[model samples]
Every structure is written in structure tokens, then in C-alpha cells.
Target chain A: MVSTYVTSSLILRILLVYLMVSRIAFAHDANEASAYTVQEIAEGNFVHEGNFPPQSLENRGDIANIGFIVGEKCVAVIDVGSSLHVGSMLKAAIQRVTRLPICAVIITHVHPDHLLGLNAFTKDDSITVYGHHRLPKQIRTRSRFYLESLEQYLGAGNTADHAIDPSLVTPVNGLLSIDLGNRVIELKSWDYAHTDHDLSVTDIKTGTFWAGDIVFSEHVPILDSNIRQYNAVLEELQKLDVQHYVVGHGSLDRPWDVLISEQRRYFRVLLREVRAAIVNDISLMDAVNTVGWTERDRWHNFDMYHRRNVTTSYTDLEWED
Target chain B: MNFVKRILTFIGASLLFCQLALATPFPEPDHSSIPEWIMIKQLMFGEREIRDGSDDILALYLNTKLDDSSTVPIMVNALMDQTEDKYIKTLYLVIDRNPIPTAGVFKFKPEAGRVKLETRLRFEKFSFIRAIVETNTGDLYMDQRWVQVAGGCSAPSGKNANDPSLGKMRFRMDDQIRLNEPNLVQFQIKHPNESTLASDLEPGYAARFIDKVAVEFNGKSIMSGDINFSLSDNPIFKFYFSPQAEGVLSVRAEDTHDTIFTDSVEIGTDKR
Candidate 1:
């Protein structure tokens, strides 16, 4: 009788311990799911402001501003974060706001930070991905390097399940409007400006413009494409009468015109100085060191990216007739 | 006591699992010694000793903190001027960790007056950029700068292959030319210099790049280089050429696709 009692009590103890441990694990996941907070900038339009620092393991690759819009029946997700973890958090954030199914995912560009989190939402068969028409080609060429970089940032295990499928993206050539029941979001793809391909979103109901990386506010503007073309695109963007706007990085407190002008001025200076350097018989190596020092204090992270801008400008404009 | 021990072991196991789930920290930049260099050195120079060139022979200049991996401007300057008796006959540009370790092998004529090479390169990873000089007496000296850049070889070439001005060349020089003195001239070719490692490149399509670059003054060779796609797109070179008299500075470049681009600028006596 004593042996039977002891055996029964031991089994009960083991069962209780297992239940407790599993429950704790479940609770931990729940906490992580709700960790990302979103602010409704406009009605039905939510934005999660990301960190200012570059992607790091500590940040879990949440370096870009990402959010989604809820309509009457479904939701449209804008640029997803950099990793699966970030995407899952955004998904959970959406669930916390509404139970609507995500019908569309709009990618702003082919950059890794905005494109890698796509797989997290892709698991659901209902979501149709949208990006620039040129995005698919860029993805095909750059995805391998981006994945390797992700592994470097988030480690092998954290990134093992991450994969970028270019075929999943629906190419947006010029102007495409997506209807989410009562709300409609217009996606416009621009010519080579910030990148070879860049897409911007506009919420028709709210009149809020998601400028993507085309209009950087506080962060130093990165010139990956033609400077003259980029400046011309900015001139066109300035004409849009936006009631509300979200930049790719930095707070959106400044006036839209001021933001556009500041970015335009940076590129203008780069174009002028680089051209002068080429004309004055200055070597490309020497020009990078001295070309863009005047705008150093005007923008953040200028030291890290300005020399590169000079290099690009010198190489491109050197070919000008 | 047995139950307590079991619970402890379970907690310990959970902690271990959690540790595994977390991200691994990034590796520190290690510049102590590169294993790739050991093997590359053996193949390029069989049992040949290399002396440090930073002190007197030549110096390599490059920014250690690279922003763009695809286009990095670098310069190599010879500390001593080129002389007929003891001049740097050949210069080797080597990137230790690239797919092709030898980026270029440039031959310099002593008549050039001085040896200076300025060009842009693509770095595949964090590796050393070495400027190796071989004197006429067969002595080798090397200067290296460690550069931190990645994915340059696979980075998509921004140049459109179907550009209308493809294979065009341009030459720039000072307004005035001096007789019997080293004058700087820069020449650039408009080519993609496409790398095979670029992922989007179609399989079975060979990557096209400049293989031979020859510069001459009045039909006499001054600088000739055997190069590869390690040179950035639209390869530009700046070097010194001594002008004994008025002559045409001509450049003929041949690519892997069997296309030849040639351009020349006349050095006028009016400037002299």
C-alpha cells in the first residue's frame, strides 16, 4: 500500500511540473507577441516607429518604420520589418487592433530591411505581395547577399527559416490602387531615384503619404541612383498636398516642404562639388575626402555615408558629356 | 531529494535551450593573420621573400572603413622615382580574399619618370589590398591596407549592359604639358566590367571584363596592365607619363567579349 501511494504521488508531481513549465513557455511567447506597440497616426492607419540605430542583434533587425492599415473587412500591410521576429510582432500588433485578414502587403523597395520580413506574412495564402516592377529583378540579384548579411546580424539559427521569394511579389509598374473594402491605398512606383526601383503608398481616405525612403527627414539621404533624377523626383513629390506623412526614418514632426528641401539641398551640394572636383583635375580618391564636408553637421550619419555619395557622384558624372 | 534534483535538471535544460534560441554575437574583426594570404602568397610567389614597402619602396592608400563595397578608390605611390637602372618594372594589385586573388598585373616603363596608379576596385569581403612592386633587379616589396567591405563581387552592376555609349573612352589631362617631366593624365572606359559571381547573371553566360589595358605616348608603351573585373565598373586610371615632346597619348583596351576601345588625345606644343 505504501509503495503504491509513493508511486502515485511521484507521477502526480511530474505531471504538475510539466504543466507549469509549458504554461510558462506559452506566457513568454505571448509577451513577445505583444511587445511591439503601434500608434494609430490616422484612423485605421497604424505606424510603429522603429529604432534610429542600424540593424544589430540587440535590435532584432527592426530598423525601418513599418505598419499596416485596417479597412472595413481586411488589412493592408505596408513595409514589413527586417526579420521574421519583427514581422510576427507586427502581425500580433494587427491582431490586437483588429481581427481582419491581411489581404495585401506593399513593399516600398528592394532593400533588405523592408523586404526580408515578407516571409512571415507569406505563410498565409490570402496575402498578395506588391512591389515596384523593377523590384523582382533587384531581389533576384541582391537577395543572396542580403540573406548572408541577415545571418551576420541575427545569427544562423535566428535566420535559418528566413527566405526571400521574388516570385511572390506582384510587380507594380506605375500606378496601382488596392481596395480594402471601404479604404483604398494607391501605390506608385518611381523611376530610379533613391534606388533603381522605389514604391510609395497613399491612403485615400486619410490622405496620409508614406514616402518610403524617397524622402528622408533626419537620416542622411543615401544616393544609390542618379542625383539629377533623384532631385527631379523630389521636385515632383513636393507638389503633393499631403495632410499627413510618414518618412522612412526619423520623426515626422517637421513640415513636409522643409524635409523635401533639406534632402534636395544635400544632393544639390553633392552634385555641384563632385562636378567641380572632376573639372579641377582632382582624383576620385582625393575628391571623396574633401567634397561633402560642408553638409556634415546638417544630417545624421553623414560621416558614415557621405564619402560613398561622393564616390557615386564622381563615377556617374565623370561620364557626362 | 530525487524529485528536487529532477526539477533542477529540467530548469537547467530550459536555460540551455533558451541560450540556443538567442542570436549568436557577431565575430570580432581579426587582422592578426589571414590564412588565405598564406596560400595565395605561395602560388603567386614561389619561395620569394617580400619586404615591407611602406618605409621606402611604395605606399598603398585606401580607406579602412569602406561605405560602398562595389566602388572603392585606391591609390599607390612609389616613394622613390623610377630610374632606368633600378625602377619598378612591374606592379601587382592583389586582394587576398577575392575569387580571383590577383586583381591586376601592371607593367611600368622607366621612361614614365614616376610610378603612380590610381583606380577604383571591388572588394568581395574584408581583406587586405596589397600593392606589390617588383624592381628591375628582381627584388619584391609590398604594402598592404586592410579594408572592411563585403558582397562587392556579387553586388549588381549598376551599369546597363545595353547603354548606348558602351565602349566609349575619355581622356583628361592638365591644361599645360611640360617637356621631359612626369605629367598626370587620367583615362576612363565606359564598360560594366561585370563579375561572374554576380548572382543574377544567367548561367552559361560568360562575364565580360577588360583583360588588357595599354597606354602609349607616340606609339611607345608607358603603362600596360593585365586586369580583370576586380576593377570597378567604368574603370578609370590615373598615372604619370613623361612627355619628351609633343605626342599623342593613346589608350587601347580589350575586353573579354573581343571588343576593343581605343581613344587618344594630342599633346599640343602650344601648351609646352
Candidate 2:
């Protein structure tokens, strides 16, 4: 009778220890699921700034700043990141903040980093997608290439769930106004600013301008449209009256006008050097490396895209009088 | 312990020898003190002596670090004036490492103002591109740029494979052809110029490209290009042509698919 009692006691102790350990493991996993930390830039405005990493399997394409605006009735999401995984995380962040139904997803442009995470909102029938008027055409023309590149970076298994659906997109031809319950958001589409199709959003209640790629703070300014038109847009942006701004890339540490001035200086350098090369009868091959090299230390990723920028500017300006 | 030490010493010695072998300069004739230039000279000119050009007479301009291998922009300008006596007669573009080393052989008349040509080409590997110019007296002058980019011949054409404009040609020039002064003429042809090494290709198809291009004026050949996949999809060329008399300028292009595209422009006299 004594031996049986001792054996039973030992079995009970082991079972109890196993159950306690499992509970701790489960709690640890729950903490990891809500790892994304969001900062409130303004009243009812929440933003999640991602790391400045290239699209890869490690980061899983969460390399852009994405945010949400919560009003009395609904929510508006600005730029949903680069993958479905990131979109899900952003959704979790929204759920943590408010239970308000997401009313709209505003895509700033057609870049994969800004536009690919759109499918995460497709499940909700009430949510509407908005983009510039030229967004649909760009999506159709460039999606396949983007998808192929994504697969190369992230394996096919990760990319299988991500895609661009043009049919669900509502093209924003001009100024469109949306009411997120009590707060009013104004969306303006510009002509060949950062891209052929670029839209900027402004919250009337908070005076915060979500200036997509039109303005970059720490990152180097990338030019995809006409340089002359891009410079013209920058001059016009100086006249806008806004309290705070959220750029597409980099930190919101600098003043808006300061960022614009710095970018303008860089572009003017490109223009002056490119025009000189053409007059001197230099080839496009040599101009790319030699032009705009003086500004190498001022911006991040200067070596990667600045040469391509020179190429784009040179070809376009060659046609100019 | 003694045997193990000897084995370790032997392994280290072998690795050092291998590194030394790899560090040896590429075995070719010395042309410009740059190894790639020496190799290129051997590949293109063989035992022939290539004369370094005077800065005032000839200069070649191209991107040294190529961004796009398939369509690298290149320009060759004769620094010397084009007079009735001395002018550039022929221009040869050679990409040493490309499967087809000779990219183009262009013959120009004195009417071609100033002897300047601008075009885009494909590069298969990181190699030297030499632009050799032959004057009327058979003097050869060479200018070369070392490019550090590859994979021009095998890049995919980001277009639909089956398009109606395949093998179609389009020609652009001033409405009126001027005499004496050089006028810019551009010709564009639609073809995949598909490279075998390109990824995202449909299974079972090898590669196809425009293999030959011939430009003639009134039955006389002005320039001819023996091209390869190094030409980008929808190959386009913009060059200066001086018209002495009103004649028909015809272009003929043949692809690896045996498809021929021909187009002609009538050089009308400019009254102004």
C-alpha cells in the first residue's frame, strides 16, 4: 500500500509541471502575434513605421510606412505595405486600437511596396479601394513583372497569396472627399509628380498631409516622371498650408519645406550636369556615373538609384530645347 | 603530430598557389595597359596593331558601368571636321566578350555631317567595347571603354510573345531631306530578340533575334550590321545621314526566325 501511494504521487507531479509549462509557451506566442507597435501621430491617427529594408524573405516586404485614421464611425488605411503578412499585422494593430469597420484603403501610387498588400482588405465587402486615375493601367502593365520579382525575393509559397486586383480599384480622377464618420479626408491626384499617377491625402481635422512619395525625408528622392514637372510640383507644394506631414519614406523628423528644398537642390544638380553632358557630346552610358555623383554623401541608397535617375533625366531632357 | 603538421602545411601551400594563378593578368596582347583592352584587341584585331587615337581626332562615349546590359546607349563622334578631303569612312563597334564580337560595321559618306553616330546595343558580359574608325586613307584609330555589366543577350522581353507588330518596321526622318548638311534618321523594328539564357521563357523555345540588318541608298549599301541577341527587343537606331541627291533609302532586317522586315524612305529635296 505504501509503494502504490508513492508511485501515484510522482505521476501527478509530472503531469502538473507539463501543463504549467504549456501555458507559458502559449502566452509567449500571443505576445509575438501583437509585436507591431503603433504610434499616434495625431488625435485618432495611428502610424506604424517599418524598417528601411529591401524586399526579402526575412522582412517579408514590410518596408514602408503604413497607417490608419480612426474616426467616430469608420477607419481609413493609408498604404498597406508590401505583403499580405504585413497587411494582416496592420489589421491586428487596427483591431487593437478600435473595432470600427475599415471603410477605405487609400493607395498612394502603383509601386509594389505601396499597392501589393491590397488583398487583405478585399474580404470586407464594405471596404473600398482608392488610387490615382492611372493606377489601374500601371497595375495591369507592371504587376506581372512585380510578381516575378517578388517571387525571386520571397519564395513562391509566400507570393502565392499576394496579387494586384485592378477590378476592385476605384480610380481617383481628381479631388475626392471621404468622411470617416466625423473627420474629413481630402485626396488630391497630381500630374507626374513622383510617378505618372501619384495621390496625396490630407486630414482636414488634424491638418496632417500624407504626402506619399512626393516628399522623402531621410531617403534620396527618386524620380520616375518628368524632372521638369517634378520640380514644378515641388514649387507648388511650398504654397500648401499644413501643420504636419507624413512622407512615403524616411522619418517625420524634419520640417516639410526643408525636405522640399533639399530635394529640389538634388534635382537641379541632375538637370545642370545632364544638359552639360549632352552639349559636350557625352554618351548616356558615361553621364549616368559622372552626373549627380557630387551628392553621393547626402542621401541614402545614392549609389543604387541615382544613376538610373540620371539616365531618365538625360533621356527626357535630350528632347528639350 | 609530425605527420599532421606536414599535411596542414601542404594544404596551405596549395591554396596560395591557386590564388597566385587566379591573380595572373588575362593572357592577351597588350594594347592599352588595361587587361580587358588587351584581351579585346586579341579577340577583334588579332596580330594587327591598333593606333591610340588623338583626342582631337576621335573620341568614344558610353556608360562605363552599364545599367542595362541589353540596351546600352553608345555614341561615337569624330572630333575632326568633315571636309571634302578627309572624313570617317567606316565605323566598327566591337564587344569583345559577346558571342558575336562584331556588333556593327557602318560605312559613312562625306554627306554624313561630322561623322557622328548614336545608337544602343546589347552586351553579353562585362567586357571592353571598342569603337574603331577608319578614315578615307585606310588609317584605323581606336577608342574603347570598359563596361562592367552583363546579361544583355539573355534578358526577357517584358512584352507579350504573340503581337501583331512582330517583324514590322518603322522609319522616321525629317519631312524634307537636306543636301550637304547632316540630318538625323531613325529606324525601329519590332522583334523579341529573345535570348536563350533569359529566364521566364516558355519551355521548349530556344532563342530568336534579328541576326542581320542592311541599310542601302538607291541599291548602294551604306551600312550593314551583323547583329546578335545583344540588340534589345524592338531594335531601334538613330544616326546622321547626309543626302547628296534624292534617292530611296531602304532597310532590310532578318531575324533568327528567318522573318524578313523591309521598309524604305524616299529622300525628298528640301526646298527651304
Candidate 3:
């Protein structure tokens, strides 16, 4: 009877310890997720962009994690990253999840925010940076400007990682393809939308298109593009079959119909305004002063962006055919 | 005959409507107030003070007034996103490119104030910019004024960055940091901070991005960092830190290939 009692108590003790430990671990995990409030937009889709915006000394947030998606063999990185440090962190993070080579880097557009980060990919033989043909040239010509921008944004003692070898530039134009063991990604360029060299990537299997700046989910679209070209591009994209997407600036989203409609409406209004200005023979300034922008109050940076859009539209309509 | 008349009327009406809409004039942004972030109260240029309380979070407040041309949301978001911490909060709000998009404020923690900086900004039309102070304890405070022009910061550096290389590093100082006070480090280095927004009148930027920097105090290592591509041209940074000993204050900088450059100053214990 003594032996039986001792054995029973020991078994009970082990069970009790297991339960207590499990509860503590589970609680810690819950706290962690809430602290960062990480919301994974797409499952099976890895993120490569380092913490939406890169690290800032004067930044207002406390969380920092590079975006990643794990693949079968070599993973696909959306934006490689800005500096060598970010690049190093990105590589380590990807390795943590998989042993795949960085198959290809898809630059959504020519903007520094999207493309400059590719310098991080060290294994040149295996990795390829896919962007519009105009991309490599832009990097070559706009390199200095990019450096200045770094100084303005990152401040001193922090730019150590911004060094990039311009000679290592890898440029591509037209359609590009990536075969990731089980998945196939097809990259297609948009004819003059956000930039002269805008490319959109579609994961054939998932039916999700990485829509660069062609679709900004949150803020107003900065106009590096003329209205006619932008409108035409939008119309062209609307005809394609896209179900899910990753926008350049805002959160990745589903339910594309509404977003597309709103973007289209904006362009339509702009075209109409410009068309009116031309007929009335209003000076460019007067025409800019005329858009009854009450609709602007509804959005955050509408006026700042709208004026640029209006200016571009007016100039395009006014200038060459 | 009635069907024919209906078709003709539709065609004529469409043409007339198009003409009327095209006949209107362009709209203009209102210029009324100053934008925020142009001032640093309590913290003067080259001034130092003890940070109150030892809590980790740094709270910074900014205010601004704006009119129609202000790209209010983008600039604000840019500022917020630039910080990356997300803990930075906006205590006040306003934008006047609309019915009343005039003023706003943002509050951030002490830890969030990585480096104090100054830059020319774009404040479409005209308006005041502002932000309030909120400690982790929940005290609220505010600051701001208006900017007169439309686009200033993004209007292009107007300097040709295509000139072969990021320019040579230039340094200036009064020979030493005033004793017991934070040292005034003035640095001007060649960098493009390329937005990739410019085109080459001449073919340039033939290499990868290169914006690397580092700073050390006395003989102790302080901090090293990577400058993002968003920094302005010929970058200028003025920072402060208290020193304990009088030693050679040296600055060493390098680019991607690890090509290093150095400059040093003799920090003496007493001033003449």
C-alpha cells in the first residue's frame, strides 16, 4: 500500500508540472503576438521587405521585423532591402525558414524604396533582380540622388550599409519567369503607369499579383506618370484576372473590385478636369485652382498629390500628342 | 423622323456638355498657415539638457497648419513611417486643402527621437504644422505654424548628383567641443540619397547604392549606422553627446567595398 501511494503521487506530480509549463509558454506566446500585432496578409507567401519602412533613429514605433515568405527550394524576395545590414538580416531570416537560394528579386517599380535593396543578394550566379528595362539605367543615372536621399532619411552614422556596386546591376525587360520547385511566378511589365518601367508579378498558382505602385492601397498615388498613360494602364489591368494583390505602399489586400473602382474614379475625374481646362483656355495655374476638391478632405494627402496629378495631366494634354 | 431627331439630339447634347466642362478654370490651394516640425523648442540648436525621468520611451511633439496644396497625408505618413517604431502618436490634427484642412500634431517618445535633424519641407499652399507632447504617463502638449510655399522638400535638390562620385567629405568645427557641453559635430559628405526620381542629362550612377557612415567619441565606440537612400544630398548631421575624457576624437567612414576615410580632432580638457 505504501509503494502504490508513492508511485501514484509521482505520476501526478509529473502531470501537474507539464500542465503548468505549457500554460506559461502559451501565455508568453500570446503576449508576444499582441505586442508586435503582426498580421500575416498571405499565407505561403513570404515577405522580404525589411519592416515595411526601414529602421529609423527618429522612428515612432518599437517593432521591427523583415517581411518574409518561405518557399520550397529558393525563396522569392519581393524587395531585397535597402542596405547591407538589412540585406544581411534578410538573408539570415530567410535561411532560418528554408535553405533555398534567393531565386529572383522582383522590383515592382524603379523607385528607390522598391529596388535599391537588391544589393543585399550576394550570390550573384544564382540570384537575379528582375525589373523593367528602364530600371538598371535609372539606377545607373540616379545613383547619386539615391545616396542623398539616404542621408536625408537615415541621418548620420547609419548609412554604412547603403554602399552598392553599380557595376553589379542586373537589368531585365519584358516577361520574366521564376520556377520555385512547385510554384511558377510570371512577371509582366505595365506600360508607363507609376514609372516608365513598372512591372507587376503574378504567382500563377496562387493568382496573386504583386501590383507595385499600380495599386496603392492607402495613400494617394504620386504622379510620375501622365494621366492618359495611367488611365490606359489601369484600363488594361482591369481587363486582366487578378484576385489577390500586394500594393507597393499600403497593406496587402483581397477584394480588389472596390479598390480598382476607386482608383478608376480618381483618374476619370482628373481627365475630365484637364479636358475642361483646355477648352476654357485657363492658364495652368487657374486650371489647377479650379478642381472643386471637396473630395480631397476625405483622404489624407489628396491636395499634395492631386496638384501634381493635375499638373501632369494638364501638361500631357497640353503638350505632344 | 422622331428616331432620327432623338439620335441627333443625343450627339449634339454630348458635345455641348463636353465643351462646358472643359471651359472651367483650374483650382488653387489656399495658403493660410505655417507647417509644423520647423522648430525644436526646449532643445535649441547646440543646446543640451537632462532628459526628465529615466523611462525608455522618448516623446516628441510637432505641429503644422496647412491649406489646399498641402500633401498632408503623405507627408504625415512619411514622417510616421520614417520612424518605424509606430509608437509615435499624433496628438493634434488639421488639414485645409479642404473645408478646413489647417492644423495637426504628432507626439513621440524619447527613445523614438533617434537624431535631431532639419530639412526644407514641402507645405502645399500655406498652413501651420503642429504636434502635441504625450509622455508614457498621458500628459498632452502642443506646438506649430505655417509654411508659405507649395512644394519645397521634394522639389528637386537642383544640384547635379551625376558628377562621377558622392563628393569628398567636408568637416568644420571651432577646434573643439565646449567642455561639459555636448560636442557640435558638423559633417558635410557627398551623397545623392537617390530617390531614383531624377534623369541623367549625362549617363551616371553606374554603380550600386553607397551611403555608409559611422561616429566614435574619445576612445570609446559610441554608435555606427547605415544611411537610407532617403537622406538629402551632401548630407549634414549635427548631433550631441557628453564626453568624459579629453582624447583624440576621430571619425572613420567607409563605403561598400570598405574603402575607409578618417579625420580626427584634439579634444582638450581646457579651453584657451
Candidate 4:
């Protein structure tokens, strides 16, 4: 009778330990699920709005908007976040919403903020990655530097097991349409704009447009490519009939046309002043400091990126005949 | 068998330790005593004394708060006018942290009334840009500026290699030519000045950059330089030249790929 009593107590202890372990695991998962919260902006479109600050350890490199669109049968992820941790959080957010398998991932550009989290979603065997035709070449050249930077920003431990495989990306030359069961999304490749290789996505059913880095809202628009071409692309984007839209950065509270026009006005002032500087034989060194001071108080992070925009415009406009 | 197993375990543990050591982020070493400068100074000067030139001989001008790493505008001006007895014969522009530290070695003639070089350069990282001028008597004087810029080496040179206007040249100067005085002239060449460290370059392809530049008036050298990809794309050079008479001011530039680009503007006494 004493032996039976001891066995019963032992079994109870084992069950208690199992329950504790399972509960801790469940709590950990719940924390992760809450970490990346998404809002259903439209009927089927979900977006996790990111902060406006630059990538830092505190932000975990989650400075760009990333989300997914669910269809009746499958889902398509617009962009993964800046790092694997952010991407995994996004994946958890998707799981919380629906159980549909992810069919495709559309990359916006070659910038580290948009491209680094790609490894997280590429793990699934059924997922196919899409990007501009020029993206693979850009990746081949830039991945090493981006990886080194990732190690610096997030510690080496967080950066471990992360690798960017450019070959996994299927090239989208001009316009390519993919079907997520009954719903179809169009991926468009653009000429040199924000970056040389920029891709934008549009959902046919919901009329939701993912502008990627092509259309930045509050945060200063970065110019990694030609300024004139960027302005031209902005004009082209103005014509699109976007019902619901997601910008690459900042809040989408304002109408899409207002965002594009603000960005255009910034570039216009930059272009005019820089061209005048060049025409007046003002040195590039002086142009950077004095060219774009008029629009100083208008934009966020203007102090950080406005000079760079001036530099880009000065160099490009100097070649003008 | 037991001994062998212990040895294998020790090897694996050592490997892990080595990786951990590599993974740990350490504070950046003090840049005041830059180790690269030590090596570069030894390689180039070889025990020659370099005096401070900021106060008397030359001045290096660059903004400490650099906006663009790939295209930073810089100017180096000689404090004294060029004369037969005391003239700067050679000017060396060096970025301490660039892959090719010596951006250019320019040779100047005493006929140029004043020496002022205004150009653009690419900085790989936050490092000192040194302008070391060698006088006709072989005296070395240096002026250095600390510039904070990064990632220029690995950033893609955005120019298209197959551009139709690859070797085109342009010249700009005052509408009226000044005679027997220091007249400023600017000339530029169209080349990518591709750096080997540019990340977007294809594998196994040699980086093509302008390696030689010669500026002359009436077949007499005014300013000539041995430059490299450390210069920014579409390299532009603005300097002062004194022409004794009406003559052709010409520029010839050669790239690493052995292609030469040449252009000239006739400086006449009357405004054209």
C-alpha cells in the first residue's frame, strides 16, 4: 500500500512538471504573437505599421512596413521585415490571422530594410520569391556588405544562420501576375526610381497597392538612384487608382496623392536649387550646404537625408548639357 | 580509442572558442595612431620628415560632417604662389582608410601662378584625408582633415558600363580669358572610375578607372596626375593656370582599360 502511494505521488509530480513546461511554451508563443500586431486595413489586406526611426538594436531593424494579403486558398507576403526576428514575428502575425499557406513573397527593392528578412519566408518549400529582373545582380553585389552590417546592427548571435540567396528570386521583368487561388495580384517592375531595381505589387480584388520604398510618406525619401527618374516615377504612380495603399515607411493616414505630391515637391525644390547652383558655378561642396534649406522644416529626418539628396542632385545635374 | 575521442573533443571545443572570439564585438581602436598610416608612410616616404603644412604651406578643406561617402567634395590650396625658387612640385592626396590610400599624385609646374586643386573623392570609411605637398627642393609638408564617411568602397558605382557617352569630356572656364594671371579652369571626363571593392561588379572582371591625367597648354605640362578609382565617378578637376599667350589648353586622360579621352579649349585674349 505504501509503494502504491509513492507511485501515485511520482506520477503527479511528472504531470505537474509537464504542465508547467507546456504552459511556459504557450506563454512564450503568445508573447511572440503579440509582438508584431497587424491591422486589417482592407477586406483581405493586413499591414504591420513600422516606426519611423532608423534601424537600431532597440527597434530590431523593424523600420519598414511589412504585411501579407490573404485569399480564399492561399496568402501572399508583400515584404518581410528588416531582419529574421522581425520576419518571424510577421510570420506569427500571419498565423494568428489565418491558417492559409503562404504562396508567394514579393520583394520591393534591394535595400537592406526590405531585403534582409527574406530568408525567414523562403524556408517554406511552397513559397516562390519575386523581384525585379535587376535584383539578383544587385543582391549578388550587395549581400556581403548587408550581411556584415546586419552583424554590426544586431549582434553576431542574432545574425547567425542568416544568408541571402539571390538565386531563389524569380525575375519580374515588366509585369507579371500571380494567382493566389481565386485572387490575382500584379507585380510591376519599374525603371530607376528609389533604387535601380524597384518592384511594386497591386492586389486585383481589393485594389490594394504596396508601394514599397517607391512611395515614402513621413520619413525622408531616400535617393539611391537618379533624382529626375525618381520624380518621373512619382508622377507615374500618381495615375494609379489605388483604393487602399501601404507605403514603405510612415503612417498612411493621408491620401496617397498627398504623399506623392509632398515627395514630388521636395524633389522639385532640390532639383531647381541644385541646377541653379551648378549653373552659377557654385562648387558641389557649397551646394550641399546651401541648396535645399527652404524645405528644411517640412519633412521628418530632413536634416539627416536632405544633404544627401542635394549631393545626388548636384552630381546628376552637373552632367546636364 | 578513448584518447583519440578526447583529442577530437578538444579540437571541436577550440574551434568553437575561436568562432566565439570572432563573434564578440570589440570597441573600435583609437584612430589617432592609425596603423595604416604607419605602413603607408613607411612605404611611400621611407624616413622622410613630413612637417605640418596647415599654417604655412598648404591647406586641406573638407567638411567633417560628410553627407555622401561616394562623392565628397574636397579642395587643397597652396598657401604661397608658385615661383621658380619655392614651388610645390608634387601634391599627394591620400585617404588613410581607403583600399588604395594614395588617391592621386599630381605634378605641378612653376608656370602655374597659384596651385589650387578642387575635386571630388570617394571615402571608404571615416579616415584622415591628407594633402602632402612636395616642394621643388624636395621638402615635404602635409595638411590633413578628418572626414567621417563610410561604405563608399562597397557601394555600387551606379554608372552603366555600356553607356554610350563613356569617354566624353567637357570643359568650363570664364567666358573671358585672363592673360599672364591665375585663371581658374574646370575640366571633366566621363568615366565610372570603378573601384574594385564596388559590390555590384560582376565576378572576375577588372575594375576600369582613370589612372593618368595630363593637362597642358601649348605642349607644356601645367598639371598632370597619376590617379586611381579613389576619385569619384566622372572625375572633375578645377585648378588655376596662367597662360602667357593665346594657346590651346588641353586635357588627356587614360583609364585602366587603356582607353584615352582627350579634349581642348582655345583660350583667346578676347571673350568668345
User: Judged by lDDT, which candidate is best?
Assistant: 4
Candidate 4 stretches greater than 4 Å from native:
A1-32, A156-160, B1-32, B199-204
Order of the predicted models by lDDT, top scorer first: 4, 1, 2, 3
The Cα error of candidate 4 at residue A299, in Å, is: 0.9
The digit string of per-residue lDDT tens for model 1 on A236-257 reads: 9999988888877887778999
Best by DockQ: 1
The per-model lDDT (C-alpha) reads 0.86, 0.77, 0.51, 0.87
List the candidates' TM-scores in order: 0.91, 0.63, 0.48, 0.90
State which docking tier applies to candidate 3. incorrect
Off by over 4 Å in 2: A1-33, A156-158, B1-71, B74-118, B121-220, B224-272
Ranking by TM-score: 1, 4, 2, 3
What digit string (tens of lDDT, one per residue) describes model 4 on residues A1-321? Answer: 999999999898778766766776699678756877899988889999987756754466788998999988899998888888888888888998999999999999988888788888887889999999999988887777778877756544556556788889999999999888888889999988998999999999989999999998888889989999999999999998989999999997789999999999988889999999998999998888899798888878888888888888888888898
lDDT of 3 by residue, A1-321 (tens): 999999999888767766666776689656543333323456556553223342343221111222444456767776654555445555666666567677776666656666555567745767766677766655655555566656544433555356554445455567877787778788787667876778777777767777777876546666676667887888777787876666665445536766677777877877787887766655344556565364576444575566657755664564423
Q: For model 1 chain B, where is the 10-residue window of minimal lDDT?
A: B23-32
lDDT of 2 by residue, A1-321 (tens): 999999998787767656655665688557755667788887877888776645544355777888988989999999998877788888889999999999999999988888878888889999999999888766765576567656645532456567788878888988999999989999999988888889999999988889888988778888877899999999999888878788888887688889989999998999999999977756576788789899999997687678868866875676555
Q: How many clashes show up per model?
A: 0, 2, 120, 0
Clashing pairs in 4: none
Each candidate's interface RMSD, rounded to one decimal?
Answer: 5.3, 11.2, 21.8, 9.1
What TM-score, to 2 decimals, does candidate 2 have? 0.63
What is candidate 1's DockQ? 0.43
